[model samples]
Target chain A: AQTVTQSQPEMSVQEAETVTLSCTYDTSESNYYLFWYKQPPSRQMILVIRQEAYKQQNATENRFSVNFQKAAKSFSLKISDSQLGDTAMYFCALRTRRSGSARQLTFGSGTQLTVLP
Target chain B: SAVISQKPSRDICQRGTSLTIQCQVDSQVTMMFWYRQQPGQSLTLIATANQGSEATYESGFVIDKFPISRPNLTFSTLTVSNMSPEDSSIYLCSVALGGTSTDTQYFGPGTRLTVL
Candidate 1:
């Protein structure tokens, strides 16, 4: 079984600043995928960024990037130029492929982020 | 990315009742999944709806409690049977278009179910 952990339950960032959310996972699989999802008050889950375990380079999507340390089993999300719209609950998820089973997503508890103006 | 929509965006149901939530995708997808997010918690996958076959449930979930129907590649429904106050959570539907290991999933606006 794979488990994702987000140690921070709540985080706050000033507008136009940068913030980093930490995430760690435990998995025996050599190949897997890591993802960060954002859920606003609307309850809409949106994919923020994703990183492939095999890739040595981190994944970056505009202002959102990840510091992926495969050896350390750490995948952290960084949001730059944070805006009020970035205020949401962020969750870290892990997806692995099993030999003869369906691929499933395992998620962390979540970190509530508040972008203060 | 695919557009997904869920019916009855929210509903307040009495205990012992059932609520069926519909999920529709704008484009055909290879896989559809159902998830539950308990209040103040993260998302937990309930089942994977396979077209033309029975849905595969996760551990702690069963067909009797969450009956799922996947009639085609773009439509599916999940029914919460014999609801209880513990079932008061947000139900979400997600779709994976490529059906590959690296394919990203797109989610629908969740259905908020309140059981009293």
Candidate 2:
């Protein structure tokens, strides 16, 4: 079984500043995927960025980037030039590359992010 | 991405009653899943809704309490039987894009059930 953990329950950042939400997971499989999802007030789970374990490079989308340390079992999401709209509940999720029983991505408890403008 | 929709977006029910939440995907998906989100809690996988067969439930869950029916490829239903105050939560249905086997999954708006 895989377990994702988000240490920070809530975080605040000034507008246009950078904020990083930390996430860690416990998994035995080497071939897997990591994801950062943003859930705004509307409560829609929007995909922010994704990182493949095989690739050493981190994944980025617009201002959203991830510091993926596979060796440390850490995947943190960094939001640069943070805007008020960036405020939301951020969840870290994990999934195995193989299908069937391991297809699902176990999620973390989530961090409530508030971007102050 | 699949356009998934859950019927009865929000509903209020009395204790001991049951509510059936419906999940519909625009395109056929290889896998479908039902999840529950309690207040201030992370999402929990309720079961895997597989077409042409009975849904496979996870630990701490069973068919009698949360009966699932998947008659076709693009649709499924979850019934929360003998509802209680503790059963109130937001139920979501999710599916993968195409036959793509990634960790990424698209979710529906969700059904918010309030048990009184």
| DockQ value for model 2 | 0.66
lDDT of 2: 0.90
**Highest TM-score among the candidates is held by which one?**
1
Chain A TM-score from candidate 1: 0.97
- Which lDDT tens digits does candidate 1 get at residues A1-117? 789999999999999999999999999999888999999999999999988889999999999999999999999999999999999999999888552343688899999999999
lDDT, model 2, position A111: 100
Candidates' chain A TM-scores: 0.97, 0.98
TM-score, B chain alone, candidates in order: 0.97, 0.95
Model 2 bad stretches (over 4 Å): B98-100
- Those runs of model 1 whose alpha carbons end farther than 4 Å from true positions after fitting are A98-102
TM-scores of all models?
A: 0.97, 0.96
True contacts kept of each: 0.83, 0.57
